[model samples]
Target chain A: MIEVRGISKRYGNLQAVDNLSITIEKGHIFGLLGPNGAGKSTTISMMCGLINPDQGQVLLNGNAPGIKETKHKIGLIPQSIALYEELTALDNLSFFADLYNLPASQKAERMEWSLAFVGLQDRAKDAVQDFSGGMKRRLNLAASLLHDPEFIFMDEPTAGVDPQSRNKLFESVFELKALGKTIIYTTHYMEEAEKLCDRVGVVDKGQLLALGTVDELIEQYGGESRVHIKSEQGEESFMTANPVNDLMTRLKGLTTVENLSLQRPNLETVFLNLTGKQLRD
Target chain B: MMKAVVALMKKDLKLLFKDKMAVFFTFIFPLLFAFFFGSIFSSSGGSQGLKIAVSDRDQTEKSQAFIGQLKEASEFRVTETDEANAKKLVRTGKQVAFIILPEGFGENYGGIFSGQPPEILVGIDPARKAEAGYLEGSLMKLGIKRFELAFSDANEMIKQLDFSIEDIQQSDDMPAEWKSLLGDYLPKFKELTELEIAKQPEGSDSSGLSFGSDGDNPMMPLKITKEEITVQKTGPRNSFSITIPQGVIWAIMGCVIGFAISLVREKTLGTLDRLAIAPISRTQILAGKALGCFAAQAMVVTLLFTIAYFMLGVRFDLIKLVLAVLAAGICFVGFMMFFASITKTEQSVAGMTNAFLIIMGMIGGAMIPLFAMPGWMQSISHISPVKWAILAFEGAIWRDFTYIEMMTPLTILTAIGVVTFFIGTRMLKLKQS
Candidate 1:
């Protein structure tokens, strides 16, 4: 568990991370969403112990962030592929393993397990310099796992990776959650946050504007459900006429229609409504 | 902590070795420089092969002997010719200095030794006064010795004449001996026509020195070969050898520029921030990077030493050489780290480091020999690490100084390394902020 209390980070006169406070429970996947310049990255940096907050403290497992003991238990996969491109996937994992002070006897086994978990077992020997963007992303994930960290901070791990690799990353995240590891995931991709997060925090201008499960967010920021109507009549007539009334009456007769939701607003709509702009700048 | 540092070091090593151009400039170029410069400067007397032209108008045994002596002297390549040919060569700049001997010099000398005074003329170009003067002076000194010998003979001949006069009187004063000496001495005495004239004045006219004609010192030749020696011989002189200091300077510069670029690249790639977030301390990250650079510099220094050894026979005391190299390597690492800390891009570092290197080389006497520089300029060279490294290398190998002699330079170099390293660490705070 982590607790951030009155956290603030100021850059000149702009508050990148305002007086923000939040609590994260163990084994839960948390998502932080915001538009550009929303201070999501700054807050993530503080959480990873890379940057210190100006006016507050972050406690992890009842200990402050950046404490050597606490840092040892956390793994960070930055937005960029921090893996050494000149080294092999295995070598990259081994490097991080050594950083965690893993004993020589267990380093190889742990590195191998991490590679397999990312489904990059066959490409472990190849240098990261030769790997594709998605492959490098997987390797980045593997690097974070070599330490078997209790808490993981992933900053848009799937930003540049293809859907196939994204799915592979999601599977790994699931596996980590099963292992009871807590995760703080930051991304601008709304669908990813919607599908993977157990709870989401929507931040804007360095402040947490909204926080809860995806369903709760959709309810709070109400948006009409998307309805697709099909009729045997000409498309122009259906478009011109009020088909919504007839469709609603007929759809109410079917069990699927009766129980159907009026597109309980996708994360993108919720994000746009909250920040008044696109998820990506 | 140790394990993490090692991992970072290994990663940095991989990066450096992968870049062939970096490896070449960082290590190979320095060695090539050392080898080239060392061999050229490592001659026995530090003579840098100078050209000299001699005009043998006398064509006499004495003049030929003098020319022979000139040829055997250190650093001279002598060519003999007539006055016209010598002048032509000098005008063409084929010769640095030219020497001229007058005709009838030997004939005059023979007469002078027999009691007649003789004169010889030598002409020299004023344009080459500095270089040509030294040779002229030595030649004149030789002529003076010969003149003294001739004078002594004349005095002895006159004394014999006095003894012969006394021999004729035979008054227990050895008068018969005096007459016999005087009878033999008068012919020789009558043979003495004039004082010997040597070395013509340096203008177009052959207005030779007239020793007997002038109311001046009789012993002084009417025309004395006046030579002046300039430019003292002290240290090595040659492009190959003189470039040692420049090479050291360039190597340090290369490191500063190279690592700064690496730092900027890592920053652009976002590797540095990522590394900072890792559990390892910042010092370890810096150490790993610096040591990696040191490893590269070591290879360069070693290559330079090997080439210099084989090409120029520049021998070094192994232990002192190693110590000097170690000190230089440390300094290079420190300098590069400092460069990396301050810059935001590799281009900036390369440009700034190159400029800094040129200034250092210029001030440190790397581009020019310190011996040729003014004292104030040489004193100013102390600010450059290259100067200190060059001093250490010269002391260890060129000067062949003992361990004690190398102590100061080595200490100074190490001190610079330590101090710069501390500054580098302090500068790294910018990254965090």
Candidate 2:
């Protein structure tokens, strides 16, 4: 578990992160969603002890993020592919494993598990330069898990990955939660947050606008679900303020109705309603 | 911490070996330079021998004999040519000097009995003053020998004249005119004929002079004998022997550039940040890089010397050579770190490291021997690491310096390495921020 308390960071004239605070519980996927320059990365950087905050502090369990004990308990997977291109995948993994001071007896077994987890066991001997973007992303994820830290911080780990690789990453995240590991993931993808994150926090301009489960967020600021109908004569739509059963009974009595569908409130609509803009904008 | 350092060093070495260009520049390029320079210097058959041209215009026995003597001397490479050609050769630097014997010179040649000896015309290159002076001294010795051969009985004549002149002055029955004329003339003659024999030239025979009270063919009172003592254990010194150490310095320089640029490359590629995120300290990363560079340079120095030992007949003290190589390697690795810290990009690091190495090489006696440099430059060369490196290596090689003598350079180099490494690491930490 991690706790960030009212942290703010400034770069010359711009306030990158403005008095931001959040709490991540154990064994859950906490997604920080925002557009470009939303201070998401700046906040994550403070939490990882990579940079200092101007106004507050971050605590990992009980100690500060930079303490030796806390540093060993967490893992950071940066947005860039930081593996050596000239070395084989296995060699690259082995190098990071050594840095963590893993035991000699456990090194080979951990490397095997890591490569398999990333679905790169067959290409373990190939140089990383020859890997595709998605493959490299998978390898980057695998490297962060080599030490099996209790907490993991990922910054846009699936930014450029393909759909299939994205699905695989989702499965891996679910599996990590199943193993009782805490993960703080940051991204601008609304659908990924809706599907993968147990709890989501919408942030923009160094401020967190909302925080709750998917259903709670949709219920509060998401407005209402609408019924849309299109016929030969004209097209009509209706907003269901109360119950969807009364609207469905009314729609069945009209034979003129051609196309009918329910447009439910989702994270994208909730973000738009909350910030008056799209999540990606 | 040490485990992390080793892991980092292993990764760096793997990347270096994977790059063919890096391996070639680090190990093979210096060997090529050594071979080229060695062949050029050795082609002249060492620095002791002088090339000269001689023209026998007199064609007399004495002139021909002098030419033959010069040809037989191991130190001279004598060539026979006309006066015009000899002068041209000397002027063009093809020969050190031109010796021309005038026609009828040997026929008119005289020793002390004659008023003057025929002069041997020597047209020497002004730039080659040392070689010209050596040749002039040789010819002077030859002239002295000719004088002894012509005036073998001159000492006996002088002794007989001393008694006769005294008897003539003391005679009582002499004529008035004869006495008056002999009296003035005898004093003048005594003053003119008073012989004070000078010391003989070295290696010259002293049996001809006879001036003793016993009158039994008086032997020469003084004998001058020349004996040459050389300090070198080997027969003679050569330029290639000294040049081998200079070549090793160049190889070390190559290592400096190779390893220094690698740090810049890693920074640009973002791998340095990745390393930072790992559970290791900044000092460990720097230590890893320094160790890697040292290993690379040490290997290169050893390889170059081993090749020189077999191909160029370069000999060294094995233990001293190993120590010198290690010291030089450490010093340059520190230089590599310092260079990497100041530069931001690979291109900048490469350009700066090259300029630094070249300037140091020129001032430190790699491009030219320190002994041959001007006094001011030699004094300033002490500040350069390359200078210390060459000194240490030469101590191991031909200089045959004792351990105490070698320690001066080794200590200075190690000190510089330590200071530079400290400064470099501090700068690297600043840059990381």
Candidate 3:
């Protein structure tokens, strides 16, 4: 289990992360969603012990993040493709594995397994600078899994990745869950989180405004469904709690309607509703 | 934990090798600096000896003997020519300087005991003033040989003694008491030498008094011989030995600058951030980075010295050189870390580190030789690590410094390393995400 309780962080005058809180159980995926300055990376950095919280605490199964045991079981897949481009894939993995102090006996096995998991085993000998963007992304993922830590933090893993690679990453996340690993994933792609996360937290202006399972969050903050019709009067749309009943009753007198459609609320709708439509830098 | 640090070093080293510019600057560039500067400062003529021209206008027995002596000295490449030709040679820079034995030089060659000093004129360009001094000194040394030989023969010594008696008797510059004293003693000395020669058995060799062959000249007083004193082994065979340290320091500085920018690059590339989350403390991460730079510096120093010793006639004490390399390593690694701390971007680190090193190199006597700098600038070199680093290397290579003497430079380098590293690490620890 991982717990972030009333954690807050400030940089000069900016409140980068407010007193936000979340808990993740073992063998589950928790999505941290936010705008550019919503403090998603800052929260992940705090959780990974890369940055210290000014107030409150983060505990990985009651062990503070920076403690040996906590750090030993934690891995952070930074959003950027954080890798030594001049080094071959195997070399990069070997270096990171040594840092984690994985047993020498298991180093080769874990390295080989991690590479295979990310589908980069064949390119292990190639320098990362020669790899495609998607391949580097996969190698980046492979690097994080070398130690097989129980708690993995993937901060925008699909960022700038092709769809095929994104799907591959999604599959890898699912596979991580099946392997009984807890994952804290952050991304701007709502659909990705909608597909992968068991729970999602929506934050804006350094504050967590909503946190729940995908369906629950949508039901709680996704606003309403919409019904649309094109008639002799003109095209018209209306929001309703029940699109089926509202569509049937509101469109009964529309004789010359050429098109009809219903819009159902989803995570994107829930995200926009909770964070507002204003753009953030 | 050690393994982790080693791993980081290996990665950093691998990256360095992959960088062609770094390899060239670290290894090849220093060698070039040493070679080019060494050739210029070391005896420029190398095996051809010091080039000089001789214009023997006297054309007399003593003048011929002086010229012969000059030719026999293998250290000089003597050129015999007329005064006009010798002047042209010097003016055109074909020769360092010219020795002109003036018309009356033969008669006045033995002028040491107060006939006028012979004017063995030197025709040289004023720009060659230092070389002209060398030419005059050499000529003077050769001119004294015939005078020294006069004592080995009774007739020659008696003649010289008689002339000296007359010269003193007629001299106005001599104090009255001195002239009176020498006027009385020279005759007595001459009479004693004549009597001694007459006492020798008939048909004895022309050397009236022989201490036998290959012995000190009993007649000659106050013989001075030159010797070279170094701390241990034969020191600096040539200028190459002196300039090798200069080149090595620059290469080491190159390594420092390269690693400083590398650290900043890692930051922007996000690898540093990734490593920060590892179970290791921030110190270990920094240690790993520093170790890599240190290793690079060591490699550069070793490579340069090895090449120098095998090919360039340079020599060094291996143990002392190792001490020097280690001290320099620590010092520059601190520089790398400190520069990395203050510079946030790769461009900033590159620009700032390079500018700082170049300035330090200038003021430190690495880029510019200390002797060539103004007195105040030379004094300022004391504060630059570049000066100390070069001094440390010189101590090991040719200065033949004792262990105690080596401490002066090694301590300074290490102190710089420790202070800067401590401050830099403190700043790094305070870095926010």
TM-score of each: 0.76, 0.78, 0.79
Candidate 2 structure quality by residue, lDDT tens digits, B1-433: 7999999888888888888888887777777777777678778654555788999899998788778877877667899999899999988889888888888666545323222467788888677678878888877766665544543444433543454456556777777787777667745644543442334345544445433334233323235567997864652145566777877788788778988998888788767866776788888889999988888777788788888888778888999988898788778888999999999999999999999899999999988877779999999999889999999988888778899999999988888888888888899987675
| Candidate number achieving the greatest lDDT relative to the actual structure | 3
| Candidate 1 CAPRI assessment class | acceptable
lDDT of 1 by residue, B1-433 (tens): 7777777777766777777877777666765665565555554445654576777778889667667766786656888777788778877888776667677665545443223233544445677667666766666665565555544343433444454444335445445665566557655543452223223333422122233555343544463567998967544434454565457656656665677678667777767776776777888878877876777666666766676567745566778888988998887777777777777776887787777777877787666766678899988988988788888877766566778889988998898888888897788855674
RMSD of each: 9.9, 7.3, 5.6
Task: List candidate 2 stretches off by more than 4 Å.
Answer: A11-14, A35-38, A202-281, B30-49, B52-78, B82-108, B111-223, B226-244, B297-330, B396-407
Query: Of 1 and 2, which scores higher on DockQ?
Result: 1
Chain A of candidate 3 gets a TM-score of 0.94
**Chain A TM-score (model 2):** 0.95
lDDT of 2 by residue, A145-231 (tens): 888888888898898899999999999888888989999999999888888898988898888889998888989988888887786
**Lowest lDDT 10-residue stretch of candidate 2 chain B:** B213-222
| Residue-by-residue lDDT tens digits, candidate 3, B74-187 | 667999998898889978889887888888887677543557766777666777666667766766676667667677676777777888887887788988988888888879
Candidates 1 and 3: which is better by TM-score?
Answer: 3
Chain A TM-score vs. truth, each candidate? 0.88, 0.95, 0.94
Model 1 chain B poorest 10 in a row by lDDT? B193-202
